[model samples]
Target: MLNIGVLVSGGGTNLQALIDAQKSGIIHSGRIVTVVSNKPGVYALTRAENAGIDAHVITKKECGSSDAFDAALCAYLQKMQVDVVVLAGFLAILGDSFLLVYKDRILNVHPSLIPSFCGDGFYGLKVHRAALDYGVKVTGATVHFVNEITDGGKIILQKAVDVLEEDTPETLQKRVMEEAEWKILPEAVELVCSGKVHV
Candidate 1:
């Protein structure tokens, strides 16, 4: 089975979805080996622990520089024999060394469709706000391979949601997240694990 290492910086709702998918046999060829968080006190760690997965925090303060943190993260993944690294709301921009080592093995779920409302400073609610401001009739999520550039990876999957007439950032986010992210994230992971996706 493919062993996955999940990285998160927030509530881990997507992580939970992966766990649920694994249990429900939707994702049959892989299992989450460990969960790593850059911040302490994130509920993602608790979610990992509750699922009996090994979970730990590797704070930025612990590793003085981005290079140092990447080194540590690489070492940890090596030790765990992780086959894939899944970024679930992980905020840090990874160093080149990490990208080189993991390459196509790292995957991320972005809140917006690629080549549109993506790039640095576009994440979480910010993405939703951008979609609303742009007055786009349709906006959704993208699951892609992770590279050096933020959200610049090759798109593996995408699901679109309509931007309604009375949509606020929060409401749009809620709808899109439910209709797309909740399904696509886990499905993307499964595709990677099953050898169906190539970079």
Candidate 2:
């Protein structure tokens, strides 16, 4: 079985999805062994602890530099023997050293379809707001491997969600999470764990 490590920086709603999916037998080829949060006092850590998963914190400020943070994160994950790294709601970008070490082993779930409202400065409700401001009729989620470029990696899975006429950024965000992000993220994880998704 593959050992998974989840990285988070927020509420961990996607982390919750993976935990629930694993409990339901939706994930069998791998299991979440550890959770690392970049930001301390986040609800994600609480969620991890509630699920009986080991939780940790490592921040850039503590490491004094991005490169050091990357090295620290790499060392910790390596020590844990994590086979797959899932960036559920993780915010900090991984530096080159870390990316080179993990390579295609990291998976990230972005809020919008890539090549769209993605890359730097596009995250959280900003992505949804961008779609709405542009009057898009459809917006969705994308699950892909994490590379050196922001949101630039091999696509694994994508699911589209309609943007309603009356939808606000907050509402659209909720709908996209429910209709797209929640579903495809876990499916993508299962695929990677089961050898169905290849780099």
For candidate 2, write residues 45-146 as lDDT tens digits.
999999999999999999999999999999999999999999999999999999998888999999898889999999999999999999889889999999
Give the TM-score of each candidate: 0.98, 0.98
Q: For residue 135, give model 1's deviation from the true position in Å.
A: 0.3
**Candidate 2 lDDT (Cα, whole model)?**
0.94
Q: What does candidate 1's lDDT look like per residue over 111-193, in tens digits? A: 88887889999998899999888899999899999998888889999999999999999999888888999899989988999
- What's every prediction's RMSD, in angstroms? 0.8, 0.7
Model 2 regions more than 4 Å off: none
